[model samples]
Target: MSRRARVLPGFSLSLGVAVLTLSLVVLLPLSALFFRTAELGWARFTQVVTSGWVAAAVRFTLGASLAAATLDVFIGLLIAWVLGRYTFPFARVLDAVIDLPFALPTAVTGIALSTLYADNGWIGGALADLGFRYPWPAWRGFDHGGWPIAWTVYDRIALAPLGVVLAMCFVGLPFVVRTLQPVIEDLSRDVEESAATLGAGRFRIFRSIVLPELAPALLTGFALALARGLGEYGSVIFISGNLPATEIASQVIVKMIEVNETGNYADATAVAVLLLGASFALLLVINLIQRAAVRRGAPG
Candidate 1:
């Protein structure tokens, strides 16, 4: 190829710059985190990571992020389809609104979510009422022998861990939405129509034709959202009520910074390493799953 036709000139210089940028922006910070963690030595590091508090935070953080990411894949695909496949009032506005989480400050998002979901707040009050409702009226003949059935919906929902999942869903949704939208928009209707003509149901056509095409994007989006949720702090802190049940790895680190004396972040670093390893393990699992999915879907 002629020099004029080249998209990027001087491959060596471009490669050098890219490597330099990656090292400075990513590697340096990660190295520092690892180095600080090493200062604690093996036994202390193990104790910090294996503590009850850390265990609870790990369980909640991992579980909530995984749930949030899984929910986002479905919800985001639906939203992407709606916005891309149909035209309606405020369509453009809705498209722009999808990026709000990215642009808005985390603190503001937390406060807003917390205010809306507090026990006395609008949505929270409704949930409390909904949860405590009776299944049948007292005047009704059967009425399960006059015993009032408590649904306990709010008890299951309004917990700190559930709140963490909610906050993660809000913050991480954009990743799934943005990742899948373009593919959804570009989807050709021919395969769908052919499947339909062959007597395939709407769900069947979607499953057999459309879903395989979307699987890679869905997995990628899920991975991104999962990573984002794992690292989330500000938005989660408020909405999750900072309780032990909802306490995340980030909160544990922050508390360690304050209570563990100045310049002493051994525990915090240990927690960071735990988080780093968990993120890597999760991502590796996602990658393996993605490859298997692609292979299964591939044509012989």
Candidate 2:
């Protein structure tokens, strides 16, 4: 047999460069974070991470990120379907606009969101007037025996837990939309048509056929969005009101660095280590789910 020619020159050199860049930009920083946390000693690290305020922040951040990512799954699927299946005036423009969150500065997005959702601002004022509120009655019940399970309608969104969720959703939306777009585009309409011809309803076709095809991409998008939302700070801080045990996010660790009192650096780095571990675990779960979905969808 004849020898095959190489596809590209300098493959070794490019690989070396890529590895070096990744190490310098990503690996080194993460390694340093772990090293700093280790310096705190295991007992102290646990003490800091398990502190009441830190625990509260972690709970709130995790909850908000999950809620936002879940919301994005539906919104992103809708937008991707529209863009992939329909043609209309400004369709291209609308598609382009979906990436605005990715391109815009986090601070700018934070400021804009804060402005738009402030109590006196456009949407917030209307909601406030309608007497809307998001009451954690279950939490309240934990503290105070038996609170009524009434749903408070029309709560103001800004500077609340809702604001944190909104910020997360804003920043995470692009991840879901972008990840799912190509998958949606690549999906064939023939399968759907055949199902319809077999007397299947729209919902049945979507549930039995479309959903399986889209599952892996959807999970990947959700993972990416959730990861981003968990680490988000700039936009979240502006709207979250930074109320400890309420709207505070895990990124408050960064603020602790500036203060530096009471061994804040050690505490912050320890919290970071926990966040990193949680993120790794979550991503691993998502990857396993994606792989399972792909396997199930494959022809046996």
Over 4 Å off in model 1, which ranges? Answer: 1-4, 132-159, 298-300
The C-alpha stretches of model 2 lying farther than 4 A from their native spots are 1-8, 137-154, 261-263
All candidates: TM-score: 0.88, 0.91
Winning candidate number (TM-score): 2
- Residue-level lDDT of model 1, residues 1-300, one tens digit each, is 654666886889999999999999999999999999998899999999988788768866887788899999989999999998999999999999999999999999888888887777788768776774322111212335653332222353344456677889999999999999999999999989988888999998888889989998899899999999999998988887777657889999999989845844878889988999988988898899999989997889
List the global CA lDDT of all models: 0.84, 0.84
TM-score of 2: 0.91
Clashing pairs in 1: none
lDDT (Cα, tens digit) per residue for candidate 2, span 4-35: 78776577987999999999999999999999
Candidate 1 Cα lDDT to native: 0.84
